[model samples]
Target chain A: MSILAVGTVAFDSIETPFGTAPRVLGGSASYLTLAARYFCPDVRLVGVVGRDFPDDYVQRFRDSGIDLRGLETDESGDTFHWKGRYHYDLNERDTLDTQLNVLVDFEPTLPEDYRSSQIVCLGNLDPAVQRHVLDQVDDPEYVLCDTMNYWIEHTPDSLRETLQRVDCLVINDSEARELANEPNLVQAADIIRDMGPETLIIKKGEHGALLFNGDTVFSAPAYPLEAIEDPTGAGDTFAGGLAGHLAQVGRYGADDLRRGIIYGSAMASFVVERFGPERLYHLNRELIVERARAFRELAAIPKLAPLQAA
Target chain B: MSILAVGTVAFDSIETPFGTAPRVLGGSASYLTLAARYFCPDVRLVGVVGRDFPDDYVQRFRDSGIDLRGLETDESGDTFHWKGRYHYDLNERDTLDTQLNVLVDFEPTLPEDYRSSQIVCLGNLDPAVQRHVLDQVDDPEYVLCDTMNYWIEHTPDSLRETLQRVDCLVINDSEARELANEPNLVQAADIIRDMGPETLIIKKGEHGALLFNGDTVFSAPAYPLEAIEDPTGAGDTFAGGLAGHLAQVGRYGADDLRRGIIYGSAMASFVVERFGPERLYHLNRELIVERARAFRELAAIPKLAPLQAA
Candidate 1:
């Protein structure tokens, strides 16, 4: 099975209460492709970077087994750069700057082979671009799309058009409320499902995520971490792991989706341990399994016997 | 086995986005005793109410199999009254008024029979009063105490003195942070555990709860409900259900604590479905079991197979 990811691949300067990272390798596709490669080797990344992109960073992606055939190089302009600062509570952050140099006139072009990708992941990007990518790919087995409040509020019509083609929508809790204009998550899920995606996952930073599929709802717990140096790219990494697991399993049964959520959660937990993609650089399958096992234990409860009347 | 609950027994005027309940029977002990009665038949309630308390409400406790021997009636003043207004989100509320008539000078005295109770649940109250009740009771099998931010800030010395005597402490997330003066929950749990109880449960309103015991941590998901009429007494109800379950099971094993958390979560979920204690009036054991099963299913994830190397 093959998975395709489309989003920014650029540089980020992040400042958190713990510390700061200057122009580290970041962007949605960077994190997504790296995390997806953990579960599915045949990952195709389609995004643009400027001449400012480092050679070693490019080599790192290649070494991670991500296919870069669809990646575009814009030598005339600088790479997209974003600067952000997080408060003491990492739950919220303020974007200091966003320079969309190469991304301003970006037009994603899928590789010939990527058209047959079984799973497509659209990271936080322009809804118009997300829909354009969907038009290029043939009917994917599963399309997982991620969006932020910016797109939902600015370009809702385009976002809705893109969402209609996605099988799953992954957004944080507040975004879900803003998108549906419903504060209640259950109601938001219903409204979003009616608009398009059959599967809706509402991510609640440290509280974990909720998976709503038709009549079934599953609550996934976030892995408890003692140290979270940086929370950059946690959501995109989550989406990547989820799409990657689904691609590897090649099925969307309830059990499979639950497992995928756990894998995604585990991956996100590791990503937040250090700044940018540093944690994933040294991550292994064994550590992922161990963390997933811990999650199972954290949520495990003894089977209840039938209630006996007193 | 017998479980003793000590707290307020008073009237509450609650207003939520959905509806309003004026001057309904509401208080920590009122809800705690009601919820605990589902699991433990011999629930001893120790609290003070004014002579204005209705005869039928007293009969209601008697009908629910909750011992009222330790409940005191003060003829000089009115019952403690609380008026609160919940925001649309239902997670935060504003205390519009607090008329602590009988509770202001309240002194809890456990009945002679209650001294031998196997489990003691100290609901949210003055820490000195909690310690007084603990002083009267013999060494019980398990002692669970709940507290709020007011006491943690105003009476730190007495609260610490009470904490050292309890086996377990349960409080909401914000209060945990405030009490421990640690923003991060993991760190806060460690700080609190070192100060007193070996086990700590931090409740996160609609987000569910986390149980920290020794080196173990268990995450319990809150039951997803479409509508929540009133969130008053949810925390106390959770404490009641947890203490009651532990007493009925008569064990403090890891498995038992996890089950107790789930039971507490379920009871709290039902409590919010209607204003005050109205929902619990008609709730049966079968419904509680069914809701608990739903929570288990919501959190159940299939065991992950070993991740295959990509």
Candidate 2:
């Protein structure tokens, strides 16, 4: 049950009310692969990094057990670098700069060994690039794709084309609304399902997340945090956790999808406790198990005595 | 166990994106009593209504199996009327008008039998009035009080005095922050707990609710609806449902509190389906049980297999 994460492996300069993280190791593929490697060992990453991409970061990925055969390095450009400032609430952010140097003209060609990955996680990128990665796949049993409002708005047709091939789509509340052109999330999920992926995960940051699969909808509550240091890679980490769980289980039943959402929610909760994705790298199996248990306790409803009126 | 609800019982003119419900039956006591009667048979209401109040609405409360012995009629003034307009999203609303006529100088003289009620639900009202009603209660085993930002800002001392006597305090997200002066809801709950009530429920309308009692927190998911006709009395309905559940169980253990939260959340879900408390009035026990089951399913996380790395 190998997971192939295809997207940018770049840098982020994040500024939050708490402090600043300068040029931290980031990008969707970076966080997704790191998170996916916990439950899933055979994680292959396909992305273009610039020549300026640190050797230490490459080593970090290798040390973390992520396959780098598909991690291409551009000879003449810097890595994709994004600079964003989070507001006081951290719910909204303002992108100050975006340097898509290497990613601008990037084209990924999955390695021969990576072509047969069971699960392909298409991270936020050009819709054409996502489909290009999918095109190289020999046989993908499950395809989980992530996209932002930028792609949904700028290249909707291409995005829809890519979405049609994916088994699941992971997007935030606002992105789902914008993409579906519907404010009501349930109806939005229904509309989106008609266009593409049967499964849709609407990530509602601190509120929680909702999984719409077939005729069922499963909700996972956000772990109540006392403070959020940074929220840079929470969404990617969530996707990673979910894909990893699914890959490990090697099935996508109703129960499996629900548990996967919980695991994803737990991972996303841990990532936001610190800046960037530092907290995720330090996590182990026991900690993850306990976090998942904590989530169960948080949303657990016990048996109740029958009402007197009843 | 008898439950007494004390608050404004009046009319509301609500304008949502869908349509308007002009001068419909509303107010905290109106919705609270209607919702609470579903769980606890001996539900008592203590509120003042104007002479202009329709007798049919009064009979409607009686027909719903609510005790109206403490419902006082004031001859000189009109009933409290609130006019509000909900935005397109139904999350934010603008208060168009507030006519605090009968509620301005309302003083309740609770009946002898109602004073001995085991559970007391103090809905959103002037802190002085909430405390006044509590003062007349003979021996309340469990006291659950709700408040708004206006009272927190306008009458801090009185609210704190009322809080000290109440066993549980239920308020929405913004009011909790305003009362505790903390932005983070978990921290806000802690600060508010120290101020008064040991148990606190922070209702996040669309997201869900958090129950903070003792050393535990129980999170409940909001029921995902295709449409929300109005959100006028959702919080009060939530409180009523919770108090009613607790009263029916006749105990307040950790498990009982958790289940109470689920029941309360289910009740709140139905109230918003239509304007004011109209939906609650037509609800039967079977529908309520099903809705609670739906909540359990909505937030249910299945028993996942151990991680592959483990």
The interface RMSD values of the models, given in order, are 1.1, 1.7
Which 10 consecutive residues of model 2 chain B have the lowest summed lDDT? B301-310
* Candidate 2 global TM-score: 0.97
Best by lDDT: 1
List of clashing residue pairs for candidate 2:
none
Where does candidate 2 stray beyond 4 Å?
Answer: none
Candidate topping DockQ: 1
Model 2, residue B119: distance off in Å is: 0.7
RMSD of 2: 1.5
Q: Which residue pairs show collisions in model 1? A: none
Look at candidate 1 and tell me the lDDT of residue A285. Answer: 93
lDDT per residue for candidate 2 within A1-310, as digits (tens), equals 9999998887999999999999999999999999989988899999988889889989989989999999999989999999999997788899999999989998887789888899999999999999999999998999999999889889999998998998999999999999989888988999998888989999999899999997888889999999999999999999999999999889987888888888888899899999988897789988898898899999888765545553
TM-score of chain A of each: 0.98, 0.98
lDDT of 2 by residue, B1-310 (tens): 8999999998999999989989999999988889888888899999998988998998899889899999999999899999999998889999999999989998788888777889999989998898889889888999999989899999999888989998999989889989988777889899999987989989999998999988888888988898888988988998888888888889988888888888888898898998878898799888888888888888888776666562
lDDT scores for all predictions?
0.90, 0.89
Q: What is the interface RMSD of candidate 1, in Å?
A: 1.1
lDDT score of model 2? Answer: 0.89
What DockQ, on C-alphas, does every prediction get? 0.76, 0.64
